[model samples]
Target: MAISIDRISKSYGEHKDVHALREISLSVHTGELFGLIGPDGAGKTTLFRILTTLVLPDRGSATVEGKDVRDDFRDIRTMVGYMPGRFSLYQDLSVEENLRFFATIFHTTIEENYELIKDIYVQIEPFKKRRAGDLSGGMKQKLALCCALIHRPKVLFLDEPTTGVDVVSRKEFWAMLQQLKKQGMTIFVSTPYMDEATLCDRIALIQKGSIMSVDTPENLLNKYQGDLWGIRTEHMYKALQDLNNFPSVTECYTFGAMHHAQVSGLQMPAELHNYLDRKYHKNIRVEKIKPTIEDCFMQLMQADEREPVPNE
Candidate 1:
């Protein structure tokens, strides 16, 4: 296994002890592009920190490349490259200097690992003489990636690497990741973007410190259990409010330009059309639509909320 986490849990606070992770268990295989998909405050960062051996989990254990995170942190540090969610490169140093500094820390020279970062480094090479702080968001990200790969670590851990990057930059970053995966390097990345979930070989949908489901994006979308309809009207905000009052609508929420409502039974669509007609909605459209990963995530979260909690 590239990484193995068993029943890992973490909490913080002197008196209240807020739970960050709830007995999370997962495994990633060698050279697989595994993703931990979830929103903020869902314990993605905490889990990454544990796996990277930066912080200790309050309970349970984890391993990276067969080296225990607790017992062999030194070994794991040498074998895994990490790019945290935030940009952490030295703002004062030139781009090339930053890369060389990290290379020195790992006891390797950029010349020794040039091939590993050639494709990524080339785009930012012209700006190598510029201070790291002066580069654009995309350039900074590329530089950070070059620094991370300087030593050619076997496993790479990227914690939401594309969070603040521009759309084009995000696309470019993922392309670089794909190139790395093809080279037989293990990669475990986390992201909150539902669209990016489709790019992974397999994904684990995480929410509120729990694992809701784990499968390929296709499987997860296929597992969607209800007839979903995209409701469009002139007034989107009002339409969303009306959807909640819909008798057959089990779930309703806004989705981009339109609102999506999960209705029960086949007859619900016709009934919804008539119901909206009575409300005098213009250009009303109620059509069955495909569910995206975000829809699946909302379904899982709602189902979890509906589940009755056991008494202590």
Candidate 2:
């Protein structure tokens, strides 16, 4: 195993009332691309911080490559690369300078590890003389990733690596991760974007400081136990409101141009179509659609409850 976490928990303040992580247990196999999928305020970042040796867990334990996170933090820090959600590079330093600084701190030189970051580094090399603060969001993200990889860490922890970048940049970043995985690196990433969950080998859906589900993205989609439909009408908001008010509607939320709905009881799509058409004078289109990762995530979050992991 590359990563092993056992009932890890953390809280803030002297009162320790805020539970950032609640008995979280997980494992990441060597060379696997694992994802922690959740929105903001979930325990994804907290768990990443613990695994990266930056935060102490109040209870339980975690290890990276068999080294205890707390006891071997010094060693763990040297072997892991971390890219926080926010850009933390020196705004005053040039891109090249920032990369060099991180490499030197890891007791390695850029030339020694340049091969590890060559793909990502070359994109920013032209702007090496430019200040990191002056780069565009996408460029800055790639630069930050290069700096993180310069030391050739065994495991990479990326917390929302593409949160603010453009769509093209997001795609490029995932490609880089795929390349890294091919090179036998263990990557643990956390993202709020449900679309990215399907790209991972496995994902842990987290919410309110707890994990709601942990499995392959396809499995989650396959296990969704609700009738879902995509709806479009003259007034999107009004349509959603009216749909929610309907006794048969269990959950209704906006998704892109259409609103997705789950019915309270089993009902055929044709019956739903007729009911909507009768209720509203305007034509309402309803189509049965396959559930996406976002749909499954919304359903899991709506439950707001985590299933207990059996004791081993």
Candidate 3:
């Protein structure tokens, strides 16, 4: 295992008691591109900090590359690269200067580890003299990645690396990750985008500081329990509310312009159409659709809501 977490928990504030993480446990295999898929405040950042040895867990244990995070903080720090959620590089320094500074901190020259970051560095090299703060979001992302890899660590940890970048840049960033994975780097990345979940080798869907489920994207979709139908009409909003009030509707939510409804029994398009005709009296279309990663995530969240929480 490249990373191992067991029953890890963390909290914030003494009196207010904000539980940041709750009994989280998961593992990342060596050379795997794993993802922590969740929205903000889901404890992804907290878990990453713990794994990178920047913060201590309130309970449980974690290990990176067979070294204990608590007992071997120094060793772990050297063996892994961390790119925090926020842009943490020296904004005043030139692009190349920032890279050089990180390389110096690791006691290695740019020439020594240039091969590790050459592909990423070359993209931002044209702006080598540009201040880090002056670069665009995509350029800053590449620069940050280059700095993190300057030392050629075996494992890479990236937190929300594509949060504010353009769509093209986001696609390019994932392509870069694919290249890194080919070079035998164990990558652990966190993202709030549900579509990005499918790109990972495996993903842990987390919410409210607790893990909902962990599995390959394909497997998660395969485990979807019921048939899903897409309903679209001129009155989308009202139709959504009406579908939610339907007796047979198990789950109803909006996806783009259409509303996806999961029904309990084998009700075809005609039944749905007839039901809508009787109520809304509008020309509505209902088609059976395949469930997506977002659908699986929504189902997991609903299941979590029904689960009972233990007493402290």
Clashing pairs in 1: none
Candidate 2 or 1, higher TM-score? 1
Model 1 TM-score, all chains together: 0.96
Best by TM-score: 3
TM-scores, each model vs. reference: 0.96, 0.94, 0.97
Order the numbered candidates by TM-score, best leading: 3, 1, 2
Tens digits of per-residue lDDT, candidate 2, 195-244, equal 99999999999887778889998899998977889998887887887888
Cα deviation of 102, candidate 3, in Å: 0.3
Residue 236, candidate 3: how far off, in angstroms? 1.4
Off by over 4 Å in 3: none
Model 2: CA > 4 A from native: 245-248, 264-267, 305-312
Compared with the true structure, the alpha-carbon lDDT of candidate 3 equals: 0.91
On a 0 to 1 TM-score scale, where does candidate 2 land against the true structure?
0.94
Name model 1 segments beyond 4 Å from true. Answer: 308-312
